[model samples]
Target: MNYFTRVLKYGIDYSYFGLLNILFNILYAIFSALAFVSFIPMLDVLFKQTEIVYTKPEYTGIGNIREYLESYFNYYLSNQLETDVSSTLIIVVGIVVFFFLMKNIFNYLALYNITFVKNGLLKNLRENLYSKVLNMPISYFLNKKKGDLMSRITADILEIQTSYLSILELMVREPLTILFTLIVMFTISPRLTLFVTLFIPISGFIISIIGKKLRKDSKEVQQQQSNFLSIIDETISGQKVIKSFLSESFFLDKFKSINSLLFKFSNKVINRKNLAGPFSEFMGILVIGVLLWFGGKMVLISETISGTTFIVFMGLAYNILTPAKNLSKSFYSIKKGNAAAERVFEIIEYNNDRVDQKRDVELIKFENKITFENIEFNYGDSKILDKISFTINKGESVALVGSSGSGKTTIANILNGFFNPKSGNLLIDNNNISQITKESLYKNISIVTQESILFNDSILNNIKIGNLDTKKEDVINAAKEANAHEFIEQQLDGYNTMIGDYGNKLSGGQKQRLTIARAMLKSPSILILDEATSSLDSKSEKKIQDAINKLMQGKTSLIIAHKFSTIKKCDKIILIDKGKIIAQGTHEELINSNSSYKNMNELQI
Candidate 1:
C-alpha cells in the first residue's frame, strides 16, 4: 500500500481525467444496481403474482423509501396490466434491457477516461527515471550494473503499469458497485443483506492473508530478473572477448544457469498469483451457499419477503460477488506492483554524492593560468595522488609524462573540474575553481581522450555535438585541421553517413581524428589531451601530431602521454611516478640531468 501511494504521486497532472472517471463511475454504479433491481417489477407484472392496486401511491419521505418504491411499482404495474399482459410484460423487459445497456455504456466511459490517467502516469514515470539517470554523477554508476538499471526503467516500470492499472478502477468503480448493490439488497430484504455483510468481511480477511507474502515473493522475482538482465548485457558487451577467448561454453553455462533460476522464480510467483482468482471465486461461492440457506428460510417459512422480491434480492446479492471477486484480484495486483514500484523508485530517489555543488558565483571567463596547490586525493584507502601541485600558464602547452596509474589523468580531471581534491585547492585565474559553476567551467574546457566516443548518428550530427551552432563550412575546416576530412569525404554519403553504434564502422585512427575534429570545432580556451595519439601506429601518430600541434597553437593545454617522443617539443614536461612528480624540465634538460627520465626515455626507443 505504501508503494501504491508513492506511484500515484506522478499522476497529479492527470487529475482532470481522474475526475471524469469518478463522475462516470458514479453513473455506472447507479445503473449497475438499477439493472439488477429492474427484475423485481418485471417478475411481478409478467407472472401476475402481485395483487393490483386501484389507487396511485401518495408521496413519502426518505425514511419510508422501501415502502414507497414498492407501492409505486405496484401502482404503475396495476395500471399497465389493466390492458394486455403481453404488452405490459414486453414493456417491462425493454426497461430492464435499457438499464443494462446504460450500465455497460457508463462502465466503458469510466474506463475510457481513466486510460488517459494510467497512460500519462506511465509516460511521466519513465521520463522521470530517464532524467534522473542522465543527471546522476559518473561515480554513482561505478558499482551499478547498466543492465539492471535498464531493467528498472523498462521491464519493472511496465510491470508497475500492468498490475496497478486495476487500482484506478478499484478505487472508485469496484467499491461503488459493491456499495450500490448492497443498498439495493437491503431495500429488497434487510435480514438477508445483514447476513451477507457479516460473511463479506471474513472472506476479505482470508484474501488479505493470501496476499501478505505476495510482495516479498514478488520482490525476489524482480531482483533475479535484474540479475539475469545484467548478465545478458555483460555478455552482449563482451561478445568479442568471449569469441576471441573461445569461451563460448563458459558464457553459455552461466546464462543457462541464471535462466534456470529465473524459470523457477517465475513459476513460484505465477503459481502464487494465479491462486488469488480461484481462491477468491471458491470463497465467494461458499458465501453464496450460506446466504441461500439463510434467506430461503425467511422467504419460505417466515413469508416476510415476497417470492418475486426475494429473487431480486438474490440477484443484487449475486452482483456483489463479481465486484468482490474483482476486489480480491485487484488487491493481489497491487501487491505485485509494489515490488516493481520499489525498484524503480530506488533509482529515482537515490542520493548522488557527486552532484554539482550549487553556488551563486558562476565563472564567466578564463584568463591567466590554472593552479593546483598542495592537492591530495584518495580512492578509498589507496592514495591516488599526494601533495600534488602544478601550474599551466595561459596559451602555454605543457605535457605530463607518466607510466600507467601514475595519477596524470587524475590531475587532468581535477584541472577540468571533473573531480575535486580531498585537500587543498584548484584555482583558475587566481579564483577558486570550487566557486566556479561546472557549466561555465566546462564551456572553456575540452578533452580528447585515448578512446573515441561517438554516437549512432550521421557523422554530421556527431561532429556537431561539440558546438551545435557550428556551420557546415566551419565543420569541414575543423575536420581538415584534424586530418579527418579526406576519409570522411570518401564515405558513401560523406559527412551525412551514419556512423553506426559507437562509430564502429570507422577505423580506430579515423574515430580518434573525428574526436580531435570535435574538440577543434569547440575552440575551447583550455585543452586536455590524455594519451590521445599513444594508441595509434607511427604513421597515424604523425598525422595526429601535426593536427594536435595545430589545435594547441594558442590554447592553454595539458597533455598526458606515455610515449616520450610525443612530448619532446612541449614548452615544459612534468614526469610523474608513484603519484608524485619526480622531475620537471624541458625534454633536453631532463635527458641531460635526470637519469630516471633519461632511462625511461631510452627504453621507449
Candidate 2:
C-alpha cells in the first residue's frame, strides 16, 4: 500500500478520479450480488407445486432489494400461467440480463479510467527520471552500466505500469466482489456462510507460504535480463570492432551464459507463481465438498434452513470462491511486480553526490583571465593532476603535450568544468569557477574532443546543434571554414545528407571536419581542442590546421596536440608528467633548454 500510495501521489494530482473509480466498482459489486440472489426465486419457480408466492426477505436492506425485484417477477409470470411460466425461468432470464449489463458497463469504466492512470503515471515517472538523470553528477554515470540505466528507463518503468499497477486494480475490485458475494451467502444461511469463512483463512495461509519465494526469484530474473540487454548493447555498439577481431562466437558464448542463468531463475519464478492458482482452487473445492455433505444432512432432517434456500446459498457460496482465486493470483502478481518496483525506485532514490553550494554565483562572460591555482585532482587512488597552476590571458593559444598518461586531457576536463579539483581553486576572469553555474561556464567554452559525437541526422541539423538558432548560410560558412564544404556539397543531398549513427556513413577525416564545423559554428570565447588532428592523415591535418588557425584568431584556445608540428605554433607549451607540470615554455625554448622536450621531439622526427 505504501509503494502504491507514493506512486499514486506523484502519478496524478487530483484524488477525485480514484474516488469515482471506487464508486463504480461498488455499483458493479451490488449488481453482481443481486445477480446471484436471483437464483433463489428461479429455484422456487422450477420446484413450485402451485403459483409461487413471495414475502419480503427478513433481513436488513432486504425490503429495498425486494421492492426493486418483486414487480418485475410478477409481470414476468402471471398467476394463470404458473403451469408454463415458473419463477425459475423468470429469475434465470433476469439474472442473465442484469449481469450482462453490469459486466459490460463495469468493464468499460475500468478500462477507460485505467488508461488515464497508466499513461499519466508513465508520463510523470519518465519526466522525473529524466530530470534526475540530468541533475546527477558526471561521476554517477562512471559507476553505472549504460545498458542497465537504459533498461531501467525503458523496461523497468513499463513493468511497473503493466504488472504492478494492474494487479493493484484487481486487489481492490476482486476482493469487493468476493466480500459482496459472501454477504449474500450469509443472508441465505449463516451456517453455510460460516463454513465458507473457515476455509479462506487456511487456504490464504498456505498460498502466502508458497508466495514467499516469488520476490527472490523475480529479482534474480530481472538482473539476468539486464545482463542480457547489456551484452546486446555492447555487441551492437561495438559491431565494427567485433567484426575486425572476428569475435561473434565470443559474444554469443557470453550471451548464452547469461541467458542460461535467466532461464533457471525464470523457471523458479513461474513455478512459484503457477502453484498459487491450482493449489488454491483444489483447497476451495475440497471445502465446498465438505459443506455440501454437512448442509444437505441438516436440510433433509427438517432443519430451520429449507432445501431451496440451502441450494441457492450453495450456488452463491461457489461464486465467492472465483473471486478468492482471483485475489490469490493478484497476490502472486504483486510479489513479482515488487521486484521491478524495487529496481525502479532504486534509480529514482540514488544520491546525486555533487551538490551546489549556497555561496555559488552565476557566471556571465569571462573578461580578465582564466587561472588554475595549485589545483590537485585524483580518481580514487591515482592522482590525475597535481599542484597544477597556470594562467591564460584573453585571446591566447596554449598547448599541452605529453605521452598518453601525462595529465594532458585531465587539464582540458578541469578547465571545461566537467570535474572540480579535489583541492585548490579554478578562477575564470578572477572569479572562482566553482562559485558559478556550470551551464553558464559551458556557454562561454566550447570543446572538440577526439570522439566525434554526431547524431543520425542531416549534416545541416548536426552543425546547427552548435547554435540551435544559427542560419543555414552561417552553417555553410562554418563548414567551409572547417574545410568540410567540398565533401559536403558533393553528397546527393548536400547539407541535408543523413550522417547515420555516429556519422557512420562518413570517413574519419570527414567526421572530424564536421565536428570542427560544429565548434566553429559555436564561436565560443574559450575553446579546447584535444587531439583535433592526431587521427587524421597529414594532408587532412594540414587542411584542418588552416581551419584551426582561422578559428583561433581572437579566441583563447587550449590545444592538446600529439604532433610536434601542431604544438610548435602554440603561444606557449606546457609539458605535464605524472600529473605535475614539469616544464613550461615556447616550443623553441623547450627544444633548446629542456632535455625531455628535445628527446621527445627527436623520437617524433
Choose the strongest candidate by TM-score. 1
RMSD in order of candidates: 2.2, 3.2
Candidate 1 lDDT by residue in tens digits, 39-97: 87788776677668878777778988777877887777788788777888888899899
- Residue 442 displacement in candidate 1 (angstroms): 1.7
lDDT of 2: 0.80
Candidate 2 residue 557 Cα shift, in angstroms, is 1.7
- What is the clash count for each candidate, in the order shown? 0, 3
Off by over 4 Å in 2: 13-17, 49-92, 243-250, 357-359
What lDDT score goes with residue 516 in model 2? 87
TM-score, predicted candidate 2 vs. hidden true structure = 0.90
Candidate 1 residue 408 Cα shift, in angstroms, is 2.4
Give the alpha carbon lDDT tens digit for every residue of 227-261 in model 2.
Answer: 88899899989999999999999999999999999
